[model samples]
Target chain A: MTLSSISSLTLRKTPRISDAEFADLRGFIYDVTGIDIPERRQYLLENRLGARLAELNLKSFAEYSSYLRRSPSKDKELVYLCEKITTNETSFFRDSKQLDVFRDFVLKDVLESLQQDGRKELNIWSAGCSSGEEPYTLGIMLHEMLRMSIIGWRIRISANDISTAMLNKAKDGVYNQYSFKTTPQEMIEKYFTKEPGGFKIHPKVQRLVSFAALNLNDRMALKRVPKSQIIFCRNVIIYFDEEMKKKVINAFYDNLLPGGYLILGHSESIHKFSRVFKPIIKPGGMFYRKEG
Target chain B: MVLAKDIKGADGGVFLAAGTALDDAAIASIAALGAPFAYIKPNPAFTSPEKDLQRIESFVRYYFQYVDPDSPLFNELFRLVMERVFEASQKGWAIPCEYERQAKSVEHLHDLFFRDQGASLDLVKHETSLSSFPDTYFKIKELLDSPASTAADMAKVVSADVSLAAKLLRLVNSPFFGVAGRVDSISHAIALVGVSELATLALGISAIKFFKDIPPELMDMETFWKHSLRCAVFGKCVASLLPGLTSERFFTAGLLHDAGRLVMFKNLPYASVQAMLYARSSGAPLLEAEREILGFDHTEVAGLLLEEWNFPAELRSIIAYHHDPLLSPAPRDAAVIQLADILACGVEISSTGMYSLPGMTQEAWNLLGLKTYDIDKLIRLHDKYFQELTSVFF
Candidate 1:
């Protein structure tokens, strides 16, 4: 069935998710993706997945769940489910105060430590890098920091997200004007080339970062990422329940090099978690540093 | 009409100074120069809402006459919305840190509505957790409202809930009530805080507990409550300026005005974020973005929820029509809540995702009977009560 036909049918009578179906689907989602869908948020799942059901001509969430569990193309459908469940509310230069700390304090601290060890390369990981802005923003900042003599330093910004759709967009290296709301005009002029539909990152800055699809819940997949000096997992962990949050934070801790830094969203705190990292409060924002 | 501060060019040269009355040509030239925003001095002598509305209408007419000279309705709407925006500018309304790249078109609205139709219906039918007011609270309220009931009657209802009685005692003795001696009993606490004030406080506190389940990912509950409390303080302050309106009721009205937003977040977190992002990207009001994204705005949701909760009709109307007070049946009450909401945003209280302060309708401004100078006093009052109330509530 076409979208219009399905929509017209749906318009006649809205499909309702029964309490049993909601529980089944909610538990299924949590088990598969580790996203906690509380009882109150049943409407969100119904709304987002409702479109998929219509497209597939499925009758209810029960049918949709069965299709995922029994279909030959279950892997592809699972990706779609992940896309729907995960939120992608991110932009370039988000929470400027935190970015300032990343640039002024975290980067400075990392660079100083690296210089002492006679190292020239820097590795930064942007976990849950939705649509690429966070990592690219770091790329632009690094380019500016090293300006004329950047030839000597090797920079690697490894960006990852669970959603393939977001990863594709991030890899495309183009963003709309909304991404530049907090960005200064001069930075736009300096680092991005204006394309017809959106601003494209300068090739040089784009080259500094790499994008991949990785779910933080997958411990083995996380191990594939190199131990990094800085890890950014901002605004991502809030979706996970306490156990999942602990698991992911532990993975991040294990993957982080000694003296490495972990930056979370401004509102997020790991104070309740284990004290593997020392919390450092600075003017830019809060960051946790792994003890040596 | 007058410039409140200097407008500077890219090179730091002053284009216009403070206290410059912007003529037609000057306004045109400023717009032509591509200034994103500018602040104007408020008229000191304009006391009545009618006069202020007229002044604002004239200002809008003069300013947009060249740019959108043909559309009278558009001009009127602009003037109404810009009244509080311009007023807020004088007291420091900064340009929001974000803007939307494109306004949602009609086609996108259809797609969104079609997709979320089922979910929207479910939301409408979904009974909020706080549907039933606590029995003790209702009983106490009923006793307080009746002429036959005494302080002893009110105390009897409250003391039935031992924890509630203990809390009431602690609160009345707290610095908020400022009693000379410690109030050890419910009757004493009632006498100290007064029957109506104590009833209102109890109702407010009880209502607050229902919202504790709101996810931290959606919003900081503490910050959200603080903002609600501030709006309540501002609403009460605004009500005090008008005659024949109970200020305490307005305070509760303000407290519950954004209750629908909590419902939205609890049920529609994804869509709520989408609305927020749409608002941020487009630089439109959060309500407009919400309507476009979710097929209904928070005000409508709030109205439905409040109706379900069987709140007072006037209070319900105040919250339901707060965003568009001109359309409200209880216009004055709606206007008070609207202006209080604006003041809450203006004073840098918690925002409902959108950073920009919302504009007020001319009818709302007219209903409040406030002068520009009254704002300073209102802010002072808000500050005094906000501190004390936040301590008591939080």
Candidate 2:
């Protein structure tokens, strides 16, 4: 074909968003979801919302922003926007190095401190947990490590996400092979049953986890979270800008018990924004703790 | 003369052994062979590509200094310019002149543009009037004005000038226009593309030729036109993104957007240099500096020139409000030229002596409704076309 045909092919069918228009949408997204859209990820916003605009017959992103504001069905559209904007790509046993640190160092230290306190209860909050992989992974680790130490210990994994769709998926507790990229076969066999649809988590493991819809941007809802001895907000804070990151970090600090552990995603760091979360360096990785 | 080492042709076969260059015949043979340099007393000023790369790095950095350092838009432009200039540097384009320009800034300000009445554009228009409007421009304008003219008449007028016809044909056949097949002749181009569009394009090309002798002190002709080529393509790309607008007129308007600035500089060198230096030293924009000294900027000058020349209303409107598009009757058209000019300024490859970027109206840019991906493709397309079409214009 001719070079002109190639040039024409580059012309997009989707109505494009200009820099100012993108900025307006970006600011609105950040205001509502606290998700920071950097200069590099403008395409993500475009690709995700281009079809939504065409479906609504909106001419520009500014018009779409207006629709989100003035339309009576905006609440439904906001949920759809949240679902589209937040990526659900994740796997069980992701980031083995950090998990190794968690399994070996954190489990021993936090448990030892809990035993000293003479409290048999353990509460863990998994913020922005998508598709149930992370919280369920933690549930399996708890079962594997405790191993019938006999009973009477209270263990619950409280998981939350902004997208109710993801919350529903998390409640379903089903997975295919892609979710087990790092989960060893025996571990999968230990905690899951092979159903016709996929691998279903055993009822024992499923009972230990509860899924809920929570918008972290809502300070009141963030306060309503169960106070926990450990909070695993992995890979979630990256979507927030510095201001929102500061807010989320402050909320996570308030929710975490004194001397409790907070494990973030391998790439996420609290040290940059907050000085209160004391760093606990381990052999392979690190976690932070609340210190008075 | 004697050679210190054996000289080989590009294929690595020895053409001359060492110490065998004392005769005129040998020198002529060396000349005929296009041998680059002799090994005698190895030239002292040679530098490595690594050092040249460092110079290019700083030059590109200096050009984009005023931009937001974290911006991906400027970063993409940075890559385009660096690639363009770096490629040229490999072909032995010396860039030391970029640094030496700091020493050449005008020290004293003068209203040199106004002090010489003979050089006044008003006097030139009223008295001399160019004897004629650059030959090809006159015929094109006459045919364009005559209501009775046909597509064949437009073709007759444009084809009378061989180079202008060739330029119009080559431009339409280019990737930007996307004409289906080869346009062999002027009539074929008029048939394929619309007659009025081709006629307008001829006028733009002839206008470029009209300002033939801008003093070397005023601007580098190659750099000026390369910038215009960039703006032309970029404006066309912007127009192409919109639904029903044709892109050729935008291309023509972009080509002649800065004709007023060229005239001001040519007629009043000292004053133009002083205005430029004032903009640089005071950190004011070039247009603002022009307005401060001369009571008007180049757009106003361009308005008078295009109006006096009896050019198309659309072309005149776009060029007149190019720098600030919001005031134009057709803000979208003016905005296309406005944005295209700023986008062209972002590239270090082709400069119009204003190192700083112009402030783009957000409303103007927003009205075009293009995404960054479109700009990315336009930059890539511009890199190819700018290189190909520089020879076509110059």
Candidate 3:
């Protein structure tokens, strides 16, 4: 049959990830990145990683796993793998309530402390920033809130993500309309300029933040980050295993200064982990505060 | 046919691996990507129309049951679409391309409409002045509303506008109306279609003129009207199934349900396109996606425009709450339009860049009191009326 005619036949067989291969792959993923894939997520791995395998011209999952283990460019491949596995679903001002708390309660408290001490410096870190929406959102909020007062204050916003691809996107600081879904129009007008493909964050807001590639599992890399008064790590820990979650929480505790705040995802909580931080319940959202 | 084995392209790369359902979008995407052919393991499911229809019904039911299980009308509408699918497959036609590449992200659309407009509900309300009602429309409506008005009174008002008079006669004499002969006289056409129905037709025609200047790049006006006409037909069909309901009003409601969307497309084509793409990718309902991307959805926009045009509260409620019928004051009327809107999308008659049908709430279904068998009959009725009614409107 001609190629055109042969194209009419429907493919019925699905590429199946065997149980043993799935276990091996999941285990390897967890060991390296601390992302825990449950048994039910075999289909997810099969679907997402199967495409990767096809691109790489690998025959089976076994070959793909071995290639990752033995390949000289394994580090590069790992980054690509992380990009596929990690869900980078984030938007500007994703949780308004949490942002309200950040603006109303947390920023006020932090500003008051800094004023009392006559310190002008403020450091904030956004973990798993994912294409820079969270950090840019923070920068915009700070700029709006401080306005004239922001000139004297030294502000540092450091954003880090596990995926280099995402970091590169964050560095570009260009975003589609999806990122501005929850953002108020005035804010968008004030902080973003409409461009051809998407919106570009204003230089004023983009200047306040810097992007870097850092895996949360890497303690040495985490130590390199400057201690911050507030750390926004929302929605990043849901992928980690229980042990990894505790380890990452500990790292956040260490990375935060006394009286610093740790903002997590709406569904995430620190109740299961360390008792070092106190949970502050505000009308908008909950955050953990390290004791002074 | 599920691919039992991998199909290699000319480049020797896997074109489509096994287990992927050869859906229309998949086929189109493969073709777009320059894949020549894919191998498939022949499945018995492809040969059985009954089985295919049953599968599609269940898939649709999964989403519909969430919205309103009490309404059997949605299931019937789904079956109608599936029957079309079966017929198309039997004819060896490729499944129609339903995927939209320029779908807008709902978030962006929301920002443009709501946040940018300072959260005002009046985005499209004042814009109604941009398209004034044709002089003939008001005179015709005035005469139709008057109790003592005769056919000559309405016809005299309509005849003042030569074009509208000609269009009215053509509509009346159309095949769908099944008149004995040509409707040559304006007064005779008014007598045949009745004063109120003629007024409704005039209103629909005049309303369509307002959107004539909408850039073709933003949306195809023909496709938009086809979608509206199909929704009208579906709404009327569903309305007829329910007793004590005016099918004509429901038809009008369905015809103009997505009128607000036209305004959005006309004013903010780029943002609207982004919202469509976002809806398709995220699997969010187009309405919700529109709300997320544009701040307020087309329903709200439609409500504002209809209110500005002095449309009846019932009609406004039907258009405004068609997405969520339970929320409307006129729940029954809203429910008919809502079910019809969903049915239109299910049958692939009209799509708002949504890949899946919006879920029906339990309240909407319970309000309609639908059953499974009624869907089969509705499908039969749809087949009878769709082409005929479409011709009349087009």
Error of 2 at A130 (Å): 66
Task: List model 1 lDDT by residue over A38-84, tens digit each.
Answer: 55445445655666889889998889889988899877898888876
* CA-RMSD of model 2: 24.4
**Chain A in model 2: its TM-score?**
0.92
Across B123-240, the per-residue lDDT of candidate 2 in tens digits comes to 3374225535678788888888889989988888888888888888888777667889887999998888788888878888888877766667557888778788889988887788
Using TM-score, give the best candidate's number. 3
Weakest 10 consecutive residues of candidate 3 chain B by summed lDDT: B106-115
iRMSD values, candidates in order: 19.6, 24.6, 12.5
Model 1, B97-199: lDDT tens per residue?
A: 2221222211111111122333443564664543555677668667756899987888788888786776667656755345789788888878876777667
Model 1: lDDT equals 0.70
Q: Compose the digit string of candidate 3's lDDT tens values, residues A1-292.
A: 1123222322112256788999998999888888877664454456556667878888889988998899897889999888766656678987675688678999888988898999989999999998899999999889988998899999999999888889888888888766766678788878888776678989988889989989887889999999999999976876776799999999999999999999987546667556888988764467889998
* DockQ per candidate, 2 decimals: 0.02, 0.01, 0.05
Task: List ranges where model 1 is wrong by over 4 Å.
Answer: A1-13, B1-394
> Which runs of model 3 end up more than 4 angstroms from their true locations?
A1-292, B1-80, B95-116, B145-148, B178-182, B349-353, B388-394
TM-score of each: 0.51, 0.46, 0.54
Count clashes in each candidate, considering only residues at least 3 apart in sequence or on different chains: 4, 0, 43
